[model samples]
Structure formats: C-alpha cells, structure tokens
Target: MSTTRRLRPGVPVASAPPPGARPVQPGLDELGTPLQDVTFVVVDLETTGGRAGEDAITEIGAVKVRGGEVLGEFQTLVDPGGPVPPYIQVLTGITTSMLVGAPTIAEVLPSFLEFARDSVLVAHNAPFDVGFLRAAAARLERPWPGFQVVDTVRLARRVVPRDEAPNHKLGTLAALFGAQVTPNHRALSDARATVDVLHALLGRLAPWGITHLEDLASATDPVPGDVRRRRTLADGLPDAPGVYLFRGPGDEVLYVGVSTTSLRRRVRSYFTSAEKRGRMTEMVRIAERVDPVVCATPLEARVRELRLIAEHAPRYNRRSRAPERMPWVRLTDEPFPRLSVVRDVRAGTAHIGPFASRAVAQQAVDALHATFPVRQCTGRLPVVPAPGASACVLAEVGRCGAPCVGGQDAAAYRPVADAVRSAMSGDPQDVVRTHAARIRTLVVQERFEEAAGVRDRLTAYVRGAARAQRHATAARCRELVAARRTDDGGWELVLVRHGRLAGTAVVDRATDPRPAVASLRAGGEHVPAPVAPATAAHPEETDLLLAWLEQPGVRLVELDGEWSSPVRSAQAVRDAAAAVAVALVAPPAPLVDDTPPASAPERRHTA
Candidate 1:
C-alpha cells in the first residue's frame, strides 16, 4: 500500500488571469519562470492494459513539490469494472480482489484533478499516464484542464550522457541519480523515484543555463561549457546579411557559411544547443575567431560564400568544398568523336554535363549510344581503316557503326555524327523520340525492369543536358543586369558578367536605381572571357545565379548578348522523361484483406 498526503483545507491554488485582461510581461532576463519557483506534480499510473480507452487505469499516484520541498502526495486504487489480466496482476501486484471495493474512476477523478491543479505535470514517458487520465475525463464528460506536461525520460536523454547511464528507463535513471526511493511495481514508489530523477536532471542542466521553466521545455542536447563560453566571440559581429568564416589558431579557414539575417545571432547559435551537429560542434571547439564579410544583399552573400568555400576547400565545410571536381561529359575533339567524362574544360568541344557523379555521366552516355550508332570503343580510330584492323563485338551486335573497320567511313558516318552533335547542343528530339519508342516496346513485352533502367538513363541524359544548355547560354553573355523587388519595397540589383556575379547593390524605394546600377557596373569585378564549355565562375555559382534570375517578378534591366536555348531543346525532353518516370514507379493496385485484425495484447509497463 502507498501512502497519501491530503491537501490542507482552504489553501488557494494559482488560477489563470481574468478574461480579457492583459497579463503582465516579464523582463528579458526573467523571460520565463525560474525552475525553483515552479510547482511540479510527478505522476505514475498502474493500468489493467496498455491502452487507455479500450482498457482501464487500476491505480493512480502522484507527488507535488515546489522548490525541492514535498508539498503533498496522492495515491489511489480504482475499480476498473472488469477483471485485471493475469499478467497485469503479476506485474503491478494489484489483484482483481484488491480493486473489488475501491472507488470507481467516476468517484476518484475530481479529487485527483484538484490535487494536480495549477502545476506542471512530470512523468516518465508522460503520454502513458496522462493519456489514461484524459481518456477517463472524456468518459465522465468532464472538461480536463489543459496542464503543461514534461517527460523526464525525454529530459534525461538530453541531460545525462549515455556513457553515465546505459539507457533512460525509469529504473535505470532512478538508480543512476541515486533516488532516495527505489521504484517497485507500485504507483507511489515509482512517482516518488521520478521526483528525485527530475531534480537531479535540473541540477545537471543548471550549468548549461537551463534555469527557467521555458528553457527546460525547449532544451536540446547539452552544449559544452567551452562552447558556451565562446559565445562572446560573436559579440562584435554586425546584424546584417553576409558571409562568415571560422578561422583556426593558425588563421586557416575551418568553415564558411552565409546568413540572410543577423550575423551576430547566427554565429552565436553555433555555440548554443540549437546547433546539434557533431561535426559543427567539433569545428566550433577548434575555431579561434570569426570573420564577417557583410554584403548588400543575401544573393551576394550566398555567391561569396560559395566562392570562399571553393577557394579554401575548408575541411569543416562539407559542401561546395571541391566544385572543381564535378565531372562533365565532353564530345572528344577528334575525327571520330566519342563521349568522354573529363574534369577540366578545354577551349573548343561540345559538352553536356556537370553531372553529380561519373556513374551518372556514364549512364547518360549509355542512353546516347542506345539511340545513336556513335562508336563506343575508347581508343582513337584512324580516318581510314587499317588492312588487318578488326571491329569489336559491339559492331557485331549492330550497337556501333564500327568506323574502325570500314563498316562505315567518316563520310558515311557524318549524318550520325551530326545527329549526336545536334542532340548535345541544339535539338534533342531525335534521342527523346528514339528512347520513348524503345521504352514503349519494352513495356509492351512486359520487360518492366529493362524499361525502368532505360527510363533512368533517359532522365539522366535529358536533365543533365537541359541544365548544361541553360548554364552555357548564360555563360556566353558579356554582361547582364537584373533586378527584383525586396520585401521592404526596395530593389535588389545585380551585375553579372559571363555567368560570374560581378557586383550587387540595394536601392531604397524612394531613390532612383539608375545611378546605383551605373555605379555598380563601373565598380564591378573585371571578369575575362570564359573558354567554351566552361563558365567564367564555378558551375555551382552559375547555378545559383540562374535560379535567382528565374524567380518570379525578376526584371531584366539590361543584356549585351542573345541568351536562348534551341526550339526543340532538352527541356522538352526533360518533361517527357518526367512523365516516363511517373508511369514507371506507379504503385500497383492494393489487395483486399477481409479478415478482422486481432486486438493488441496488454503489456506490463508503458515505458
């Protein structure tokens, strides 16, 4: 049997503010109620089964505390109107006979609700106990007070290191925190044990500045003391859009990032609990100082951040560190042109990718070969076939034109070469039409797996070609100016030269933007002409610019060169490929199951 400490008569509990009256607001330093001033009702429940509505709660226990002082306790057994399952009987030591004369839930609900009024509820896996109580209230047609609940199990996972406690089970945490009372099967003993665990967790969180009630609610994985101390490093940073660099002791750049909001707040967050990434935490510890490069617009800041990450190849930054490593599919500059994946761009050659990987680029090549009779052999083929030269197995299977063995001379293969060149540069309808027909044929033959493979290859080719053509058109222009209206009714102007962001400026809504545009043009970076198939800036940087330019409400202020894709461009192919993909992955019809599902079995503990 667990003991109950009844509430003293005439003691008033706190209530909500009167209707329509404004509540008093706390100061910044007192943003939330201090943890010590909060009243907590630690609770546990013993139930006949795991479910709430379907089963019933057999016993209820709770302890009320404030400022570490025990104010009261509540414990009771209720008649569940049914027999307790034998497993639950063994688990909770509450037999069917023991609940025979106990008060029904209808009789016990009012007293328990009054005991827990105006307090934050605490529990190990709170949903299990609180859910049962709410279900009971629903059954009685009583309006259950919406109490703020906290789960100590969730709090322990954040506060206690896994090394100190192997798991966050109630029994495990109770023992780890040295609780005064050991939890048995009974309700009150577990509630008493949970109170001690809750206090110990609060103590551990104090050093991390989680001293307030709202802080406890929002607290995440603990930020180290050293990391917290370094928050001061962000003090002098300006509150504006910009790029930031974290520098190590040797002044080597460790990481580069951009912020569209306040640089100071963003940098400070790196040292706070919100930055939960392990690699970022390690980077912060190694970082010695932060350097800010404030920009006039968020786009400029993003572009500059990409450039810096590419230049420094920062060890701590995972993305855009090696933009130069991206592979492109180039039509080799030879008498017999063939697709080749190359890293560096040359002055003159048709190219079709900045593919995500070599494997994807190769797939695109396969799609082209399946459609065109371009040679698949790697070695350079002579203008004329040698006397004893032999054609490989590809020629035997009609997959290649076999120009190496005079099956088709360069003159005869000119139309095939021209078709492949057209597909790579201007018109891709031939490849798209060929692939669609083959896919349909495969599907008719019920070769779904083969059809899917062809679909993926076609998708890779079309998407990569479309992206490449879009990039090339923009990169070919000498200078382009564009503008978009900002949220504050100002204009954000940008000067781009050969796909590189040369300059950016923000103009006030009241002021004329012509002078600012002229000034930006005069002061912009001097970018030289880019070699064919290569953008003046990194492909990633150009990609960012293209995306920005394509956004709604953007106006083209000026242009120096024609920027256009072909009439039957790869964009159309891309759309067709998307349709094929949808048809390929469509789910099959669902099967009907006529038999009823069995009820879930009761468990020993909700935890």
Candidate 2:
C-alpha cells in the first residue's frame, strides 16, 4: 500500500515582488555560489526525463538558508514546450498537465538566482541536479556564477558513520532527521526535505569539532564505509525499476546498472561482481555514493540503462557502456566486387546491413555468396606477392574474373560484380542474378541445356538463402527476449540450436558483451544468491550468434579469442551429432570362432 499528499512547507518563503519579478544576485565559490555565509540553497528539478542534459526541466525547487536556519524558499513547475516522459512524470509527480501553464526555467531562474545570492549551493546528488541547472544556464549564456557547493550526503557519511548507512539515500537520512517523506516524489517536497536533513546533519557535526564552514568545504567523498552499520539496500529502496550509478570518493563514477529488484541489492551485487575480483575491486577505498533513479517499470529501467551506459561510460560497465559501431557486410560496387569492411555512407557498396557484429554479417555473406557468385575478384583486394602470377587458380576454377591477368575490365564487369556485392549486403533478391546471366549467355550461344540447369540451380539457391535469412532474422529478435545467466559456476555454454558451420558464439557474458567465450580470468562461479533466478540473455552473446547465423548478410562484434563458432548447415550438424551418440552407445561385437559346425563344442550338450 502507498499514500501521497502535499507537504506543508517547513519554512515559509520570503515575500517577493510578483510573478516574473527580478532581484539582486551575487556569486563566488566555484559552483557559481557565494562563499560568505554558511547558507545553502538545496535544489531539485523535475523534468522530461532522467537524462539531465537531453531532457528539459518541468519543475524546480530551491530551499534558501543562512546560519543553518531557513530564510527563503522557491518552487515552480515550468512548461518545457513538450510533454513530460511518462516515466519522469511518475517519479516526480509533475506531469505535463501540471506544467502546462507554469513558467519555464528562463522565466523562473532569474528570480531564483536573486534569491540565492550569497549562499552555498547544496543537493543530495549535486552533480546530477546541478548538471541540469548548469546546462540550462549555459543555454542562456549565463556563467554558473561559481557558487561554493556543499553536499549534505558527504556530511552524513562523515558524521553519522555506520555500516547500516552505506547507501546513505535521502529517504533513510530524512527519517534519521525526524523528517518524514510521503511516497510520491515531488520537487519542492524533496528539496525541502534535503534542506532539513542538512541542518540535522550539521547539528551532529558540531560535536566532532567540525563546526567551522571551511572544514566542511574541504571534505570530499569516497569516505570510509561504516560497514558495521549493516543496512540492506533492497529493503531500503522501492521495488520500482530504474538505473543506478556508483560513485567513489570526490564523486568519481565507478559503475552503472539497471535493476528490477531493490536498488540496494542490485548495487550490492556489484561489490561482488566477477570482474570486481579483477579490476573493479581496486575501487574498495574509493566509492562514496550510490545514486539511483526509481522508475515505474522494468521497461523504463532498460531504456535508461542503455542511455546512461552510453552517456556516462562508467568504468565498471564496459560491456554495457562500450560504444556500439553498427556492423555491416560491405560489398563494393566494382567490376569484380569483393567483400570489405566499411561504415557510414558510401556510393560504392552495393549491400550493407547495420548489425552489431561481423559474425552475423558473415553469416549473411556465406549464405548469399553461394547463391550469387557473380563477383570473381575486385580491384581493392590486397594484391598477392606475385607480380606476374597471371590468372591464379581462382580464375581457372571460374571463381575469379581473371582481372589480374587482364581478362576483364572494371566497366565490362560492373553489373554482375555489383549484384554480388548487393547480395552480401543483405539483399533478398540475391539468387536472381544467377538465372539472369545464364539466360543471357544461353540466348547468345543457343545452349538451352546449360541454361535450364542454371535456372533450376538459381531457383534452389534463392529459396535456400531466403529460408536461412528468415530464420537468422528471427533468431536476432529472439536475442532480445533470450534468457541469460551471468553468475554461472563454469563456462557459460550458449546452446546454438541452429547448429552452424564455423559455429560462432552467440553470447558473451562478462563486463564486455562479445562472442561466447571462456574467461580464465574469472576464477570460480559467480552464481547469484538464490533469491532471484537467472534470466535476461547477454547482448554480446546474442549479437555474436546473430552475426554467424546471418553471415554474408549480417555480422557480430569480435570476441576475445577464437569463439565457439558455428557449424554451418543444420542437417550436417545433426548427422554428425547422431554419429557421435551411436558410437558412444554401441556395445562391443561378439567374437566368432572358425571351426567346422559338426566338430565344434560338443561338450555343451552335457548340460
């Protein structure tokens, strides 16, 4: 069960001139705030989304204080010129309906800045909230005004030290300060509560001979954990799904994750990640914060996770955060076309697919090439050492157009070569080229018998390529919903049901999603606690499998080593498997005796 209600302001706001009224402003300490008073303006903003820079703000809340007593307060919901994302609205309780008539940041910031004059800026997670303010301020060409900033989150960990407080979330600290927060998160309400917690925390800090303002300013994060405090993150956070960020001392980002479980537990697993034993654990003395965004559903979490991983590029999330270069199977538009690596727009490539892996691209290529062997060779192909090798065996076998031996010219060979390139680039009409050329050659030579054979072969090839491409494409989609297990006790075997030749790995389970691989680096099992079962397939593995199965048409990103590549055709794989099973099951044959039937073994009759 949950409840929602408006919180009566704890401190009344100072009277101001009317709406859109302006006031005097001053600034000093780094983050665009003055250094004079012990005052702090704790801020929180509700916007179109959690992506601070890309998403615009719909609401802003700033609490003004001096000498640890509230002096003024500001709150406003701004019209962002767009509807708020459903997920953001759910988190902040500030929907588009609520912000339709509200003023925008430009209209509100001028007044807020005047009210914030000569005060230290504050926020629970200063980097994120302030980041939005700075970006918005930048659009107006206003310098952040270099205000000295202080984080109450940093203070609580230093003064209230305990293992139970490892996470130090706003909600937990709010309760600790005798300030209660209702369920639905609203901008002004949360900002006010953060201000209250800072005051409460400052009161406690006084006893540790830490009363001086300068002493607090010099403090940084990655503070030592009060491990003995013993707090559980799952029990602390709502079950809502969202993205999480791990910050070490001084607010250096360590990792990021998406979760449908307790934010605390999801983050806690990172403390025990298989990679942690390698490089991640080196962060033991550094992490001072765990920031999270609780969304309404798992779908939002997934979307946010992908976005954050790309934007932040956290150190520990390499597999999720690495840059994605959509792979494509390139077929050059040359006289004797050849396969080549390419990205972006180019006039020459006849075919290319935007895949995540080369293997998938290769899979598409392999299937298409057999059907459309139109390109025998190309100009760009690396020249072998033979300067006068004359046509190699490929030209002899009819696989090459003999361009090296001067048998063909780029202009004359352009069309068929272009067809081959297009076929490998994921075109479905690949097998048609074979029949077209055979028909034309037959018409010129009057060779009806060979033309008929070519037609039949072309038909079979097209049908086969289409069928294989259909399956490969479906497998790619299945990867989106495929099951995954990261905490396996042994080599994470990804079963390739399609059984391909050059059997490429379809799953990579480590911090980097690559082809299916064996990591001697991860020493034992990384089995998760029994509370949650294994699910959600690794993208790296699925991407790799897709590349191999769809090769010549699609491809996958490379793996760490020689992966468990595919076995090509499914029928051939099944036959081989059956043979192995039979060999294992068959019993030893009986021994035969070479003796005349009438004279042999008469002693047995006595029995």
Could you say which candidate leads in TM-score? 1
Where does candidate 2 have its weakest 10-residue lDDT segment? 527-536
lDDT of 2: 0.51
Q: Give per-residue CA lDDT, model 1, range 1-607, as digits (tens).
A: 2334432221122346899999888688667777878998999999988898889988988999877777888999999999876435535667688899999999999999999999999999999999999999999999999899989887887767655876788899889877888997689899998888888888777777677788766775677899999888898999999999999999999999999888999999999878866668788998999999998888888899999998999998867577678888888888888888888777577788788888998888988888888998888888988899998898899888889998888788888778887888766666666666666666645565576677778878887788788877777888888999999999999999988999999998998999998898899999998865567888878889989998999988888776665545675556644445333334321111223244422111110
Cα TM-score of candidate 1: 0.60
Residue 456 of model 1: what lDDT?
75
Q: Give the distance in Å from residue 17's predicted Cα in candidate 2 to where it truly belongs.
A: 45
Model 1 misplaced regions, further than 4 Å = 1-220, 434-453, 573-577, 581-607
**What does candidate 2's lDDT look like per residue over 435-501, in tens digits?**
3444445533545455444444443333333333333333222112122332342222232322111
Worst 10 residues of 1 by lDDT: 598-607
Per-candidate local distance difference test: 0.81, 0.51
